[model samples]
Target: MPHSPDDFAPYAHTSLPRLLTTAHLLSGAPGDHREPTELVRRTLVRVCARWRRIPRDDVDFYVRRFLVKEYLRGSRGRARRAKAQRAVLVLLHWEGLREAEIAQLLGWSAGAVRSRARRGLAVHGDDAEHLRGLFAKAATGLVPLDVQLDAVEQRGRALRRRRRGAVAAVCALLLVPGIVFGGNRFMTGGSTDGSGGGAADVAQSPTRIVAPGERVDAVPGAQVWLTTDGKHWSTPEAPNQFLGLTDASAEDTYRNKYQDKYKDGYGSGRKVSVESGKPTVSVQPDPLNNTSYFLSGLYRGLSADPARVEVTVDDHRITGTVLTLAGSPGWGVWYARAPLSPEELKASSVDGGPTVTVYDAAGKAVARGGAAE
Candidate 1:
């Protein structure tokens, strides 16, 4: 029942770009010469081992999905996790996956998928029409196909070298006297945080979500435990404060983005809203103490208290966490307390830079607005 290298030949030949592209994204090295290869090298080992289990119905689907998951496995933090999800969405969409289909595969509703993709690709909207363009091109322009293939092969060599190095390390460890335990930990990639993923582990530091419109430093009785400007600190509470984790108004963000679209009949018959709501973005508290803060916003002109709302800003997409049912009668509210920082917002705030967009539960465009400066 063991599968052979022959079983993976097809994937290498046809999906090389996707594999390389995903590796590049996950590694955060779109231009790196070696990271992509290392990722491909590692992924191929998994694929070959599991070849027999890969579905016969759509080999490409399973293969590509597997690649993304493998990359995510090595990634660190919730922010990185969200980034990985966004990259996967854009990459898969770039690879011709249908909006609804991608949504289902990723555990997202069809509507959420559309909204995420639209915002992620808002900068690439023009080029997206040409489906035949390679996925790598979307991120790094057209990398030569041969170059991609070369990286895949290079990974094998690097992995073999790593194995030999690991063995040498183990041999050295045996000769050392009192350092055995410490050496073993190092070899296994153990870390001080205990998760090996890094400092962002939620177990070590839980987020203190400020309520919408509440200043981070102004949390009642909470002194400055964290700070970006060095002068200001969130609560000194280890489990309570973190910086710039997104605070949004589910309703305001929606209204600011879509109010104008609806009135102009952007997708009139299909229910597109251009109505401007001018949603206010803030870092606020989650009374439940679950996340950093609800990135909450109140928006006007929602279509039928949408079952879901998707908010995309900067490089992150947040699905509504708490919804206020028509609090202002005709207003729709949505919010998510993200772990992102205030510095992170500056990247999305430049003119013609990234903008925030909101979508209805059905994947229809509700509204969009520029990121606050």
Candidate 2:
């Protein structure tokens, strides 16, 4: 497959800033120890090498998608999985790709893609402020524009040498009749199961959370939040674990969502508050019953024990208590479990899992999170 110089040149030169912006945000910093230019140079090299296979229209979009997707995956055995859901959302709403296009790119259903994007936006709050912060920072990095350009050019030349060496090796291998044809070309196309083009941990699983409990508005430690969809229900599982509800559609969506943000039910740990450490919030399927996701993570800092925690699903506030497994506080994990009413599911999906307020033993509003910050 061959591409004209005209096609390769524009995609290489024009797409660099967009690619750099995405790379900067996802990688926290672009390129290597001595040079950050490698990120841009290698991406351009890969896009050019695979130019023939990639469709021409929206070529820049495809390249940007590939750059972020592959860069998030990194090169070693352990891939970077943090904030993957946000990255995918950035590709969808931020990058302006439609639901159908995202589905085509990631091998997901249009409905499912829409569903996940909605959920992602709900958690992270889709807004221009985040983007403003992103590009604002991108402007400052990579000083001395001439030197940066020179570094990119130098890396591009080095990449060409490596690619040529690879081609020669392939040619030599072809000379032997019995050798298997496993082409390890630097170029690759998108994968259907989302392993190739989407941002996710390839081996990620779904996380589970309990619905808001009785006697309490939201459990003292509401680990995860679920929209008010009644297609789900609760059931018992382990001594201290929550395997309460299950939904097949959510199961599929969770698999597609990637990365386990709230696998362990929220507030399962000893630390009730965090001064420095950012704990993980995953949504995983219940291993015991293949049903619901448990608590995700701390949405706000709370007192030693909030007698009651309030959760807002769809805009309606639901009060839940710190439910102890089998009425034993020794279970040590308090959770808020609320399943949305049918009428509310749609709205909850758009606005789920945000804490309304936490109450002390005397039932007073604990001012924190949201606009308070």
Candidate 3:
């Protein structure tokens, strides 16, 4: 299974623009050409040298990891203050990856990823549109692909010669804890499903929300806006816990332990199929009080375009707040709060216990999610 420059060229062409934008952002200077360009070039060289040995399925992710490390190793001054925050935001929004996916990439726990990401979001979440604009602008400034391709081949050969084909050391440097996303690579502006296409059509499911409750709306209803306001992240019931949600795909949502598998209408650690177009929900219990819960997740794949997210707990339904970046194709974060009596709380599972549903603008139920035996 040997690979040559010709074999690797196509991938490099498709990935270079994104790799350049990531480098520019991580450098804390989206408009600057010096740091980001060099970072991408060097990382590309490393990938090119190991092209034959690196698994084909992971080439994109491997490139991203190398870019992050190279950035961290070289970061300094003002750029260091919010490095984690910036990195987390980039991966979540720009890359469309879930918290767990990012955790794997960064060698951190999912909880750690959430905590730092909340902090970062508190600072720049409201400016999502502006940030995206910056990324798009940066993509235009990348070094010419042909010039970089030449550099990659030449530098890759030199690196291989110096190391004498010792890939073990290189592999060790690249090793980081997390689940491998088999046959997936970094894709910009589309779904990362293995089908090599856009997001799948939303499918119907048995999941349902209680009727005759407050209708879902687009206005922000959460206690605190993680993307805007900087305060109110913590409640008396759950000190310092972020009460906002980030967008996660159906797969990422169900994979979480708290929401995985259902038994007798509850998430009970059994396998379940989370169909496309059906919304996926995760609940975070308030640590100090057993009465309140925070619900959040994604609704991007529905057959009908999603207009709102509705949550039903103990027959009480509430309109969930939605966060969508400008220019995005109807995909963003949906969150709601459920305060239940201790008895009611104890009766439900922590993560997938509530009934969450998504509706189109015409108020049709486009997709459904939550525990159902």
Candidate 4:
């Protein structure tokens, strides 16, 4: 049988006060209170539509739980709603709602609600006490009740305004450094290679060398490639050398060339050690060719310069002149030759093998040659 209007009227009227009170408590202040009320009204309307299925005992529980869950989930705006909900919870606690009932009303576990309530009380209880004290003092004086209430409301509004201003100031302070750093990077055209070009371009270009101990910015769109010769190379065009590419044979050739160059000691088995802080080096080992090559380095800050790197192996020191060219940052392709003599290899503690070092744009060492031991 269809329910008559009178049959639903009592439930609707009785539910109104509960919903309004809940909304008001959640709303924080007059300026923020209306929205919570509207939200509560809508939620209740939806719950009521399903009233037939909900047991009479559970209807209030369900509606209250829904409001609490919505507030916790922060469906509206977290920052604003969270503050309002905290204010509301404070009022509810003061009204003598037990921790368990508050939990049910807020759609949180009872323990969680109790913990949060305790913390909230610790933070706001003093203010509430002060307000109550002010009201009590006013009540005992000649001021009218309405006038006392008005003064309390004004004080609360002022406090909230001051708190909001402090929060805004803190947010600005935290964001200023990020804004400056980002703006400087953006204005300088994104690459800090010291040459004012993209970091990837500087890395890939045969002509470009990252100076030692200099910072270079990363290129947002740069692609890096590796050759078995211990050189970090970059290219705008996709080099056929990447994994699963069509130029597998070309990559094999490049790998073979490095292996052959290092097969017998070429530069008295000399090895170069490179490291860096700003640009990071990536390598891929070609199992078939027994070689690994440079992939890419993301450059940043003073670590962008390549010339600051030091390269040395055994007794053969990498003179500063050679270091200047060989350690230039960005990407470099280096070849490590086998020991010139067994004695030379033994002296360097290498087993007839070679080593390579990669340096960042800032001349800070970033990577070392593959372990041969």
> Per-model C-alpha lDDT, please?
0.44, 0.41, 0.54, 0.39
lDDT of model 4, residue 299: 23
Q: Taking the tens digit of each residue's C-alpha lDDT, what string does model 4 give over 1-373?
A: 2233233346655665555554545554434545665566555544444444444434555566555555545555667545544744543553446664554344334456656655655665646565445333432322111112233334434555676799999999988986976675555553323245434322322233433211111132222222212222322332223221122243334445455443443223222222333333222222212222222211222333344222234544221111112433344433222223434433444432333344444434555433241
- In Å, residue 172's CA in model 2 sits off its true spot by 4.2
Candidate 1 TM-score to native: 0.33
Q: Quick one: best TM-score, which candidate?
A: 3
The reply for model 2, stretches above 4 Å from the true place, is 6-11, 27-38, 51-55, 75-79, 106-116, 125-154, 157-161, 164-168, 171-175, 178-373
Question: Candidate 2, after superposition: displacement of residue 62 in Å?
Answer: 3.4
Clashes of each: 53, 46, 1, 46
Write model 1 residue lDDT over 248-334, tens digit each, in one string.
233243334444422322111111223354332222222223233334433445444433344454456555532332122234334
lDDT preference between candidates 2 and 4, better one: 2
- Please give me the total number of clashing residue pairs in predicted model 1: 53
Candidate 2 similarity to native, TM-score: 0.36
TM-score per prediction, in order, is: 0.33, 0.36, 0.42, 0.30
Off by over 4 Å in 4: 1-7, 31-33, 73-95, 105-107, 126-373
